[model samples]
Target chain A: MTETTIAAPERSRRANLLRTQEGVLFVVLVAIIIGLSLLSDRFLTVNNLLNQTRLFTETALLALPMTLIIISGGIDLSVGSMLAWSAVMLGFSWQLVGLPLPLAVLICLLTGLLGGVINGLLIAYVRVPPLIATLATLAIYRGFSFGISQARSARGFPEEFAFWGQGQVGPFPTQFVILVVLIVIAHLVLSRTGFGRWVYAIGNNEVAARYSGIPVERVKFTLYAASGLMAGLAAFIFTSRVTTTRADAATGLELDVIAAVVLGGTSIFGGSGSIIGTVLGLLIITLLRNGLLLTGVKGDATFMVIGLVLILAVLINNLVRRR
Target chain B: MATQAGRLTQAHRQRGLFAQQEAVIAAAILVMTFVVSLANPDFFSATNLLDIAVNTAYIAVAAAGMTMVIVSGNIDISVGSMLGVCATIAGELARNGTPIPIAFLAAVAAGGLIGAINGALVAYARIPAIVVTLGMLSILRGGLILVTQGRWIESLPEEFFFSQRSTLGVPNPIWVMIAVTILVGLFMKYHRFGRAIYAVGGNAEAARLAGIDPRRVYMFVFVMNGLLVGLAAVLYASRFTAIQSNAGQGFELAVISGAVVGGVSILGGTGTVIGALLGSLLISLIGTASIFLKVSPFWLQAVQGGLILLTVLVDVVRRRRRA
Candidate 1:
């Protein structure tokens, strides 16, 4: 009771730390950075690094909540659609309703939260499976986006609004700054809050968590809402950067976000993950794309390289874990 | 004891009744087909029906394999991309004067190799099926692009086109579909290996205890899926007379949707070849109907999304009532 039990916990904790999938991901990230730097002089340049960081900001923002949701054992297949829908809402609020820029941003985020809440309620409370529920919402939200936007793009936003996407703080892009702040906030919420503990507990074992008096449903619901909120924020940055909003904006983006999260060592079955790993994962993805572009890879070939890297990363992670 | 026995018998009868309820979905599908035919006289034309069958054949074949894979508790979103890769290989071979049979074999083998990689990662490496396959999707697409240098290969030998051409008063693609359906149906119903798939899907832990290697079973399913997808790719390339990296873009959604509508559960462990075939037919008909009914082509994705949602809802309701 004195020595054996105390030593057991410490040993297991160390094992957990060493055995994490993120350990492999971190190694892969470092390896890729080194390899790419060697492969291309441009890859290590400060300008390219900044561009890579900016490129990843929107995707990283979306992946933060996605990490939480997946950790809770659910998926948000609708995030891509949610991004488009949120953007459309923001566009409408700005161009049609003539709302203030801040108010438009608020509405966009609110729309995303509402979408996430609906997904959460349906999956958590109504007992619908996550994939199906989110798949449905993906269509609904995308359809709504198209309906509202009439399959057209909304553009010509105020300069101040677009500044969020393009402006920089010191040497860092605004989007990059936004992503860093968001990641910090997310890291705090996930690591320090009771809600975070509940999420992990629920993902590990929902019945046991429920039996232990945790509000499993509420936590799950809030996680999904958080996912939506992040998606909304992503839309803001994506549209701002692109300087246009279309119904099909962010089409197929959910897969990329999910891929990054998974590559970052997040388990699809949920229960354990970290925002830091996701941040690294996003950086790895951005770097891969940028490096490929610098190397003159184009179109689908770039996707192929990224895909190979993802498979190799996960495979190595799995092999390491087994050993 | 007598009261308990009576209650048990009542419960058994209730279960039997519920099993019969699934047939209602089949009936609904039939009724819809009839109504659709009534709405458009052209729909009942033998030529149009044949067109539908021919169009459905490739997807149906792929969906058959996908159904088994999904029922065994995995997925292959890369089928679309795999198809693209396979088609490129076959087209490249055929263009170089390879015999049709050998080219077809080469394509299928290429797909199988890709699938084997997926199998290795998911089974031996213990990676999640979705992430592995999602990566495969991109990898295959990228490989295809690199191989063709983003150019469409439009020239193929005349024999390559014969697969889509009619023979014996039946479209060759439809004939291939039928042959595949019969063979797969027989295999699923009687083969020991096939039975293992159901056992694994039904309960992996129990199957493992019963001496089945769930990983091996999953490997077989993934490989078989890849082979079937290759076959589909052959048909696709033959029909279109062109192979490009983007040829199978969004094909995964169509095939998965077909499987879902055919009564395959996305969660896996339940589905049928016949159901998948029917689901393929339903989906094919929808696409055809959209064209015949002059609905905007833009709405195709939205409508398909709606149908997927409806199918999942039906599955959920059926499962709930059974419980």
Candidate 2:
């Protein structure tokens, strides 16, 4: 091709990239980083970045499964409640039931898995809408959490458990490392696997996917189950870091987790999303909160900021994705 | 053409089920009443039944508006937050000696304004109703906290407690609820706009083709929802002298569940005011019955969740059979 023709195509390609979901997310992420750095002197520090990200591991873990679930045209609103339930179960199992640490963790994970299975069976077998099914479980799971813990908190986990949450390997937080590993695995599964393709197929059109021989129900079941498992993992980390587990742990966190996935450019109606975008979204949220808190805006003010960001993110996603 | 036939049958079946569901709900309430009274005769006492009526009336009033929104193919989870905001505003205004009428009108106006904003965004911006309302829920809640500075508003004028006054033999709220329900029933039954909501929700593309503006309908339903929320807020305050920042934290879920249980399809375009009212009554009765059963308060959440799931499951099965 001639020089001008090549140059024109190159420019158009770059423009096209900017219009993509990930491209827009990256730009917003970069802009937020720059803005926060400008607003707070402490924002650019490695210490602050690490600490902020570490705080986000809980949400990040939930978001990974959430991304996949949403991509499959389903939502798990009970994940936050599942986190609390699993956390309480873990604490009670270890402290009250006198189980070993590993056994307690397994119980927590199993509880979450069981919760997810219930959600799956409700939606996949009964054909209940994911939203309603999970919304019901959200309350049911939360009630059980309080009933099991009697609204009490359990603290004083063994030092080794705390280390899993608090320790770092050469500046990387153990929790953050765990999240990164999960993200990589999630990213791979979503981008390079038949199961991922099936997820997208189902999300794009469930009936069509079924007609094409995809096991729609089974896939949906697995997605929800996986979401619950991740919530369990998230709960484990959160309880370990805080060294406490309560009935109300992770209260109102469903919004934060959903917001992260949506802000990551996942279509709420489903069929499109990426683990990378979610990670970027998570980073943006963590940094925004860190910067805002550092600048002395806390509590409800921060909530407003996060809420606005979520709305704006969706708004932008809609605008850019409009044909 | 086949799909159109299916829609017709579905609508016809729903109309049939509408009456049957009401009967079913009434019977369910009666059965619970009988059981509870057997366990503890006090549950059937006038005072307890009156309390249940008052509480059901408040929720049913909100559910009436939500029924319209859902029937118009949209959902608003922000009703609870809207109630909180309206309560705080009216409470603050009443605390300042603003006349009840003026404060009431102001709260309704503010609620309408918020709803209008939500409507505009959903209609014009093409944002999903769920996301819009979810964002609004957080924004309004955070804004309320900021506005109230986390302080409780107390010392409202006696006039604001007009809902406590009985008309003839019934409490004011029950009467107001009856009046409101009748008005909504009339509107839905006789008004073109009301029919337009059903048409749009049933099939928006067809609605557009038939010269109905779905966007306008969406806006109207949301605004109406806000107005009802405003009224509910007033009633809420009249019932309680003190209004806290989190006056209606989970109220939306309760109200929505009532609507859902009342047979208002979450998928929209199929519900009735009578059904919604009955649904609210049944749920309220269950709450009282739980007390009579001597169940721990924590179990109520699980019970409510189970009820919602069961209702929706039944709905799905019924729809499937008709289809």
By TM-score, the best candidate is: 2
lDDT per residue (tens digit) for residues B223-321 in model 2: 998998888888887787788888988888888888888888777777778888888888888778888888887677778788888888877887787
DockQ leader: 2
Q: Give the per-residue lDDT of model 1 (tens digit) for A113-164.
A: 8889988888888777898788778877887888777787888977877677
| Clashing pairs for predicted structure model 2, backbone only | none
* C-alpha RMSD over true interface residues, model 2: 1.4
Q: Residue B301 deviation, candidate 1, in Å?
A: 2.2
CAPRI quality band, candidate 2: medium
Lowest lDDT sum, 10 consecutive residues, model 1 chain A, at A14-23
Candidate 1, Cα interface RMSD: 2.0
Candidate 1 residue B114 Cα shift, in angstroms, is 1.7
Number of clashes in every candidate structure? 0, 0
Q: What is the lDDT of residue A69 in candidate 2?
A: 90
